[model samples]
Structures are given as structure tokens and as C-alpha cells.
Target chain A: MTAAIELNAVEKRFGNVGIIRDLNLSVAQGERHAIIGPNGAGKSTTFNLISGHIRPSSGEVRLNGDVISGLGPFEINRRGLSRSFQVTNVFSRMSVWENVRCAVLWATGHRYAFWKNVDSLPEVRERTSQILDDIHLTHRRDVPAGLLTYAEQRELEIGITIAGGANVVLLDEPTAGMSHAETDRAVALIRRLTEGKTLVIVEHDMSVVFGLADRISVLVYGHIIASGTPEEIRRDPKVKEAYLGEEAH
Target chain B: MNATTTSASNISGKSAGDSLRFYGVWLVGIATLILLPMIFSSGGSLTSFSLIGIAIVFALSYNILLGQTGLLSFGHAVHYGLGGFAACHVMNAVVSHGWPVPLPFIPLFGGLGGLAFAMIIGWVMTKRAGTVFSMISLGIAELVASSSLILRSVFGGESGISTDRTALPKMFGWTFGPQIQVYYLIAFWLVISAIAMYALTRTPLGRISNAVRDNPERVQFIGYDPHVVRYIAFCFAGFFAGVAGGLAAINFEIANAAYLGAIQSGLVLFSTFIGGVAFFFGPILGAILVTYLQLGLTSVTGVWQLYFGIIFIGIVMLSPGGIAGLIMMHRPLARAGTLQTVIPSYVVAAVPTLALACGVILTIESIARTHSGQSSPINLFGVAFTPASPMTWASAAILIVVGFFVARLSWRRVADAWDRAATIARDRGYLA
Candidate 1:
């Protein structure tokens, strides 16, 4: 079977500031993977590349057997690749429900379902409720998503990201800002949502990654210096010294 | 599944009973609109009706950009004026040269001209949003307005342009002379154009435009080019504005520089705001009120400009939602279940609005009375009137007092409606 996602010698650069270079990694089907590294390791860039927010300088990115290297984010999303942002990017002015419904809208072939009262779309409503329940945002569904507490807003952002039903989900630090309780709640939600998803996350939280990821890749200064199963990565001294000691987490 | 449909999110408080009430109001609104022409029983009234129809279409088109899309174009008249002028040119050519095309087809020529112009300007203007975008639209307007004088041969050298509407189709029994005939013709086009514009808002392009307006970066992330969204909206707005301008040309039997001039641009802006920007049909209501005010106030008081200015400023400051915004405030209150308690406040609000209206009327009449035109004293409906009269001052004082109370009452209603509406929206799951 084709890898769920493939990056073959991928290279990305922003005017000589190389974000990713000669990076090669494959996310196998149903694998929960983590890319852990120091600052500027291009953890987010890799997410951008796979989600098609940015084009690779030279390399191929394949999602399940089809190349979607230079496709726009929505197109890539349509092909089952959805990603959340580092910054909480929920629609501030619209209700949390409207924010979730927009995700349901782009997918599910409801593009021109005007005249059907937007509130009454069964599929949209159903999916939006599921997203809300999964993220524990049911109580705040009516509130403008922007007015939510930071942790609640962060959950809604993740809820929106996966609301599109993308098979492959790129999560760029879902627990960037949170209390211990909030972080644990987020980890639980992520694990539940990623059960059937091919996942890649950039996280500084080691316990969360070790507890969740099937595999982990160590990226250091735009290069993937280590890639293996969690057990193999844990035992590899070079990997531990280059990543854990130099900028240990 | 709608958060709003859920018990937690049902902000409309609209259960089956409320839905029935909502639909009742909606049906009544539609029924009244259809029945309106009956009230104006005479054919002559159709003339006034059509003027409002054209204003409605024009202001509605203007609102799509300014209100919905959050754009402010100072030179929006470039299309209105240009469309009218182009239609006039088409009329001049088609009639004098005997092009043999039907008369209704004339508006298409105007629409196409406006579309082409908008396509070019929209490309440049849509590159940015908000202040930068507004500046570009205004610049384009200034550029075109200034050129109308230089391009004397075509623009008619500041005298503007004119055409003969009667020169069109005599194939049918209609000679097109009666204002009533043109009024009906315009009414048909107005309805068609308004429907088209409203439908446009419900389309994918429309959704994308709103999305782009709210969060262009998000739209880009979603793979839509924001510029493309802007271009489509621009071209569509131009098309309707063009049609409206064409009707304006046919209405007056003339089209000129003034149609595309700075003042015409200002007139559209004022009218759109007066109508309220939120609802699709609000501008239509706005145009009717504003045009009537301009005409009625001008006849009664010489300083109609002052009246227009005061109303314009007041609406902008006091009623940013326009009339529709005010009307829409009802749903939130009904949801809150406290609209009954606000009834007294409504009465208080109406008092002040009436008072202000009279204050404005007197203030303008006072100014106009003292102007040095030195014309003969005019007969006021029952009494002869001149400047600097004790009687006029006394009458003005009474009007001002009445206006003060009326305005006070009006504001009370406004505040009560707004406050209760807020509470209601919150109760119904719409707010934080």
C-alpha cells in the first residue's frame, strides 16, 4: 500500500533561510507521528508543505498515492489533508457553530446549497454538533467563538480543522498554550480524533508525544537527523544527544 | 444541528409558534408590498413609484459593496454616470443612424460599458481592502469626473448629455411619452435587477466575497484568490448600477456630466446609508425616503441642502444599522421575552424624532428666509410669509419644542429596542 503521506528528499527555503532541506519522511497508514526538534526546525513548515499552504522548492509530497505538492490548501483539504494553525485561527466574529458549519460546508458537496436555510442543513448541523461535543464546546456553541477563553478557543480551532473530515491531519502544536488540565484534555481529544487519521504533530510536550506517537522524528536545523519508532528513537544516543541534550525538552 | 437550532443556541426563541409569527411578519411584508400600488390608484402615481423603484435598485446596488462587502467607494457614480452617459450615446447612435436594434436593448449597452470599466478599476482597487481600497475607488472616480470636462466632444462639455427616449420603439401602441409608461418599464427592470442582486448574495461567489471580506488570509488558506472574489463583486455591482443609471437616463430623457459627477456619487452614498446597510432591501427604502426628502424639503424650504446634510449626519451617527437594522432588532427582543416591558420606551422615543424633524424644518426655513435673493415674499399655504417675522419666530419655537419631544420619544424607542434586542439575542444563544 502507498504511504499515507510521502516526502521524498523534500526541500524548502525562504530566500536562503532554509526551513526544510533534503527532508525525507513517510507517515504510514494509521500512524501517530511526531516531529520534535529545537526552534526553527521547520516543524510548522513541514505541516505547511503537506497541507499545500506552501510549495516545496524541490521534492514530491504524495497523499495516499496522489501527488498534491502544489495544490492550494482547500484542494489539498478536499483530498483529505487538513491542518490546524499554530495561532488559534477560529472565526472571531461568527458563532462557534458558524465556524464549524463552514468546515462542513466546503466538504460534503454543499457548495451551492443556498435557499436551504443554513441553520436547517441536517448534515451541517449534525457534523457541527459532533465537533462541538468532541471538543467539549457544546455549552459555548452559541457564543461568538472569539469570546471564548483561550483554551476553549484552541479546542474549537482543532475541532474546525478536523471538521472537514480530512483523513490526514497535520496538527501544529495543538497544546501551544494551556494549563496542565487543559493540555491533558487536548491530548485526549487529539487521541480520540486521530484514531482513524494519519497524524503528524510538532509538539514540545514530550510526555504527550511519547504517550501518543507510534513513531517520532528528530529534526534539527532544517534536517531530519533521526527517524524511527518511539522505542528506537528513545534508545538512539546520537539522536538523544543531538536533540535532547543540545536543546533538551 | 444548528447551534441556533439547538436548545442552547436557539437565539431566535423561534419555536414553532415563533416561526409562525416570523413567517406571518414576512408574509405580511410581502403582501403589503404587492398591495402598495393599489393605494396609488391613479396611473400618475406610478411615476412617483418608479422613481422610488430606481432609487431602491441604485441604493441596493451601492449597499452590496459598501455594507455587505465593507467597501466604501467615493467614485461609485463612475458606473452610474458612465452607464447613463453610455446609454445616451447608444441612444444617439442607434436612433440617428437607425441601427434597428430594439429600445430595451439600450440598457445592455450601458451595462456592458459599466462592466468593462469596473473590470479594469476593480482589478486595481481590489488589490487591497479597507482604507487603501477606498482611496483607489475614490481616485478612479476623481480621475473620470475630471476628464468629463476635458473630453468635451463626447461628455458634452460640462452641459452633460441628453437623449430622446421617444425615438425608440413605436412597434407597439406605446409611444413612451407618459411618465407612467416609463415608470412601469423601470419597475419591471428594478424588480428583476433587485432579485438578481439578492440572488447573487446567495451564490458561491457571494459567500466567498463575504469570507474574503471577513478574513482574506483565511480565504487564501482555503485556496480562493481574494482578488478574484473582489473582481466578481465589482463587476456585478457595476452591472446593476449601470442598469439603474440607464433607467435614470430614460426617465429624464437625458443623461449628463452631473449623473457621474461628485454630487451624484455623494447622493448614492447618503441614500444607501439612509436605507440601512444590513438588509438587501433596506437601501430601497432608504432611496425612497431620501429622494422624497430632497424633493419635498427643497420645495418647502430653500436650503434643502441643510436638511439633507443634517439627516445624513444624524443617520450615520445615530442609526448605523439604518432602518433595517432597527427592524431586525425585534427578533432578539422577542427571544429575550421582554419586548412587552419596552413598550413605554417606544412611545418616549417617537416623541423626540418628531420634535427633531420639526426643528430641522424650521432651522432650514429660517436660513432660507434670510437669504438675500430679494425675491417677492411668497405665499405660505395659508399666510403670506417673509424673512424676519415675529410670527415666523413664534411658529419656529413651537415647532422646535414639538420636535424636541418627538426626538426624545424616538430615541427612547431606539434605545429600548436596542437594549431589549441585545438581551433577547443573548437569551436565545446568539451572544456571549
Candidate 2:
């Protein structure tokens, strides 16, 4: 099977400061990998690079053995790589169901259906309803997404990113503002979503990361400090040292 | 369970039902177009209704970009003028050189002219949006408007170019000889243009235009470039604007620099702004209202311009949502089941606003109107105060104050109603 995503010696520079430098990582088919770092450690930049939102100064972003380093984000997404934003990104004016429904319609090539009704499309609605069910947003499906609480909005944002039926999904800071119960709900949803997909996440919350991620990668100051299983990540003295050091500061 | 949305469902039907309702709207529009000549040929008042139709389509084109996609272009006349000029050139060539080109085929050239203009201008304007984009568009409009006067060789100086459509190909061998026949021709084009534009809103590209308008970054993150989406919407809007221009050329049988002037741009802006940019129908409402004001105000007084400026300012302030937006304001109220409660005050507010508007109109007319031909003095009722009369002035002041207070009081109620609805929504399980 083709590697879902491969980043080789990826380096990103903003003026003179490197955001992501000399990073090499690969998410194999069905691997759920988590990138954990403090604020401004290039955890998000790594995902941005992988998602093609930012171009690498020198590196290769390969998807299924095809170089996609400098391709536009949508082009990368169209090639089966999709990602959620750090903050929630959804059609605020549209209801929760309409938001998901639009994603489904676009994906199913019902985008240009001027004469046909979108809600009448059984296949698209079915997929949308299923996704809503999985995300536990089915109850609020008819509610305007703008009216959604902080936690619910965050959930809907990830839900839209994953709604495109992509095999590889990148979720950034999914549980950022979530409460304990909300975090548990999000973690369970993420676990369910990542079951058959190549999932990579940039998360600040360690417990949620440890709960959902099969493998963990520690990123410090734009470099991958350690890459291993969850237990190995917890046991790494360097990882502990970085977290403790940041805490102390 | 939302009141207005549910009522709107009755008009537009539910999700799938909307398709049928849309089809029905098109059918009625086309039927009206088909019957327009029959109804208009016997007429005085009816003959001018088609002009309103053409302006509606034109205004709608402006709104497609300005209101829907949030890109304001002052140079929209490029497409409009190009459409008219292309049609004129086509007709002139067919007449002068005896080319076998049909009259119906001329608008294709107009459409092509619109597309070409869009391709050129869109490439530049779509690169930047908002203030920079608006400035560039204004510069372009000014440049084009000025060029029409300078490039008199092709633009035909001030006299313009006119062609008699007498020998033009007949629709089923029935010559379009009468002015009313021309009105029907314009109406047919308007209906087609409106339907096509309305259907366009349902297209993916059109929906994406809204997405880009709301947040370009999110659109880019989704995988498509915002510039590309904007370019496509601009090109389509330009195309429609050109179509409206072609219809105008057919209606008047003349194409001139005035059609391409900065005033032309301003009039379209006035129409679109007043109509409300929120709905597809907003521009149409604005256009009709503006056109009526133009015809009515110009006849009533010499100071029509001052009134237009004031109205434009009022629209910008009080009608920020536009006329269509004002109409749609019923949605939340109806949804909250409070529309009935608030209905009385709306009529009350409208009374003072209307009285104030009439008071202003009358004051201008009293000064500007020459009854049998008066010398240097003007009088209103029994008192004399020149064109700036004190009695007239006092009435104007009274009107303004009353109108202002009435509008303020009614507006406050509308705000209160919105807050109440929002509070209720939050209390219910609907909010979060």
C-alpha cells in the first residue's frame, strides 16, 4: 500500500526564522499519529506543510508516491488529504446539517445541481447523516452552526474536514477548549473517525492525545524530538524534560 | 419551527420543493414575457414597465458581485457599455455593409463582448479584493468613461450611433416596428437573464463565491484559490451586465457615451444599494425604485440630484440591509411569532417617513415649478421665500424631524424584537 503521507527533510522559513526545519515523518496506511508540542513549536506548521497550506523551502510532501509539496491546499485535499483548522472553521450561517450536507454535495459531484434539490440526493444525505451520527452532532443538525457552543463548533469543524470522504485526515487542536466531558466525547469521536484512515493530529492536550493516538511524535522548536508508540513517548526522558522545562518557564 | 423560514417554505417550498417552486417561478416569468407585447401594445403606463425590467436585470448583475460575493466594482459599465456598443456595431455593420447577420445573433456578439471585457478586467481586479479592489475599479471606470469622450472615432462623439431596426429580420416575419414590440424584445431578454442568474446561485461556483466572500482563508484551506473563484464570479456577472446592455441597445436603437459614463455607474450603485444586496431580488427592487425616482423627481423639480444624494445616504444608513433586506427582516420576527405584535408600529413608522418624503418633494417643487412663468420670486402657499423659502423650509424642517423620530422609534422596536427573539432562541434548546 502507498504511504498516505511522507514528509522528507521538510524545512519552512518565515523571513529568517524557521517554522519547521529538517522534519522527516511518514504516516503509513491506517496509522493514527499524534504530534504534541507547546505553543509555537511548529506542531501546526508541520500539519500546514503536510496539508500544503505552506510551501517548504526544501522538502518533499509525497502522497501515494506523488510529490505534493507546493500544491494548493484544495489540490492536496482533492488528492485525498484533508485537515481541520486549529480553531473551528465551518459555514457559520448555515445550520449544522446544511454545513455537513454541503460538504457531502460537493464531494458527490452534486455541486453543479442547479435544477435538483440537494436534500433529495439519497447517497449524499445518507453519507452526511452517517457522519453526523458519528460526530454526535445529529441532535443539533438543524441548528445554525453560529449558535453552537464553543465545544460543539469545534466538533462541527472537524466533522466538515472529515466529511469529504478522504482516506487521510489531519485534525489540529481538536479538543483545545473542550471541557472534561466534551474532551471525552471528542476523543471517542476521533478514535471512531481514525479507525480506517491515516490520521495525524497536532494536539496540546496530552491525555486526549494518549487516548486516541496509537503512535506519538514529540516536536520541539520545529524539530521532531522523538517518534514512537504512546508508552515510549511517555517514557522518553527528553520528552519529559521538554514538557517539564516549558512548564518551569 | 422557525416562523419566517417556515413561511418562506410555503412560498419557496422545502429543500426539494424549492426546485419545483423555482421551476414555477421561471414558467410564470416566461409566460409573462410571452404575454408582455399583447398587454403593452395598447398602453401608456404599461409601455414603460419593461424599462423597469431591464434595469432590474442590470441592477441584479451589479449585486451578484457587490452584494453576494462582496466585491465592489465601479467599472461595471465596461461590460454594460461593451454589450451595447457591440450590439450597435453588429447592427450598423449589418446595415452599412449588408452582412447577412441576423438580429438575434447580434446579442451573441454582445455576450462575447461582455466575456472579453470580463476576462481582461477580471484578471486584474480579482487579484485584490475590498478597498484596493474598489479603488482600482473606480480608476478603471473613470478611465473608460473619459476614453468614451476622447475616442470619439469609434464611440461616435456626443451624437452617438443609431440604427433603425425597421429592415432588421422579423420575428416570424412580423416586423418589430412599434416601440412596444421593442419593449417585449427587452422584456424577453430580461426574463431569460434573471432566470439564468437566479439558477446560477444554485451552482457550486456561485455557492463557492459566497464561501470566498465570507472567508477567503477558509476557502483556500478547503483547497481552491480565492482569486480563481472571484475571477469566475466576476466574469459571469460581467457577462450578464453585458446582456442587459444589449437589451438596452435594442430598446433605444442607440448606443452612446452616456451609457458608459460615471453617472451610469453611480445609478447602478444607487439601484443595487437601495434594493438591498442580501437577496437575489434586492437589486431588482432597488433598480425599479431608483428608476421611478429618476422619472418622478426629474419631472417634479430641478433639484432632483440633491434628493437622490439624501436618499442614497438614507439607504446607506437606515436601509443598510437594503429594501430586500428590509423585506427579509420579517424572517426572525415571523419565526419568533412576534410579527403580528410588531406589525402596527411598522405602518406607523412608514407614515411619518412617507409624509417627510412628500414634504421634501413638495418644498422643492414649490420653488422649482413655474405655474404660468413667474419672474424672479417664488412663493409657497401665501408666504414668499425664494426657492429657499422660510415657510417651505419650516415645513421641510418639521418633516425631517418627524420623519427622523418616527424612523428612530420604529427602528428601536425592530432591534428590541430581534434581541427578544435571540433571547428566546438561547433559552430554548436551539441555541447551543
After superposing the true interface residues, what Cα RMSD does each candidate give?
5.5, 4.8
Residue-level lDDT tens digits of model 2 in B1-432? 211121012211246767677778778867876776675565544546667777887898887788767798887877888888888888888778877766666656776777788899788888978998899888888887778777877778787778766666655664667766666667767777887787676555665666666667666655557788788888888888888887777777888888877788888988998888767777888988988888776764566898899988987887687777777766555655656766675676777768677567656665555453443444334445444556666777787788878878877876675566656654653333
How far in Å is the alpha carbon of B342 misplaced in model 1?
Answer: 1.8
- Alpha carbon lDDT of residue A35, candidate 1? 94
Per-residue error (Å), model 1, residue B398: 11
Predictions in order: lDDT: 0.75, 0.75
**Ten consecutive residues with minimal summed lDDT in candidate 1 chain B?**
B1-10
Output the lDDT of residue B145, model 1: 86
For model 2, residues A1-249, the per-residue Cα lDDT tens digits are 878888899999999998888998877889999998777889888888888878899989999889999898878877888899987787665567766765665577764345564445678778888988888888777676777899989988888888888888999999898888998888888888867998998887777788888888888899988889999987889988986366544
What lDDT tens digits, residue by residue, belong to model 1 across residues A88-138? 876565567666766667676665444445555577678878988999988
TM-score of each: 0.79, 0.88
| Ten residues in sequence with the least summed lDDT for candidate 2 chain A | A111-120
Candidate 2: which pairs clash?
Answer: A74-B223, B3-B335, B4-B335
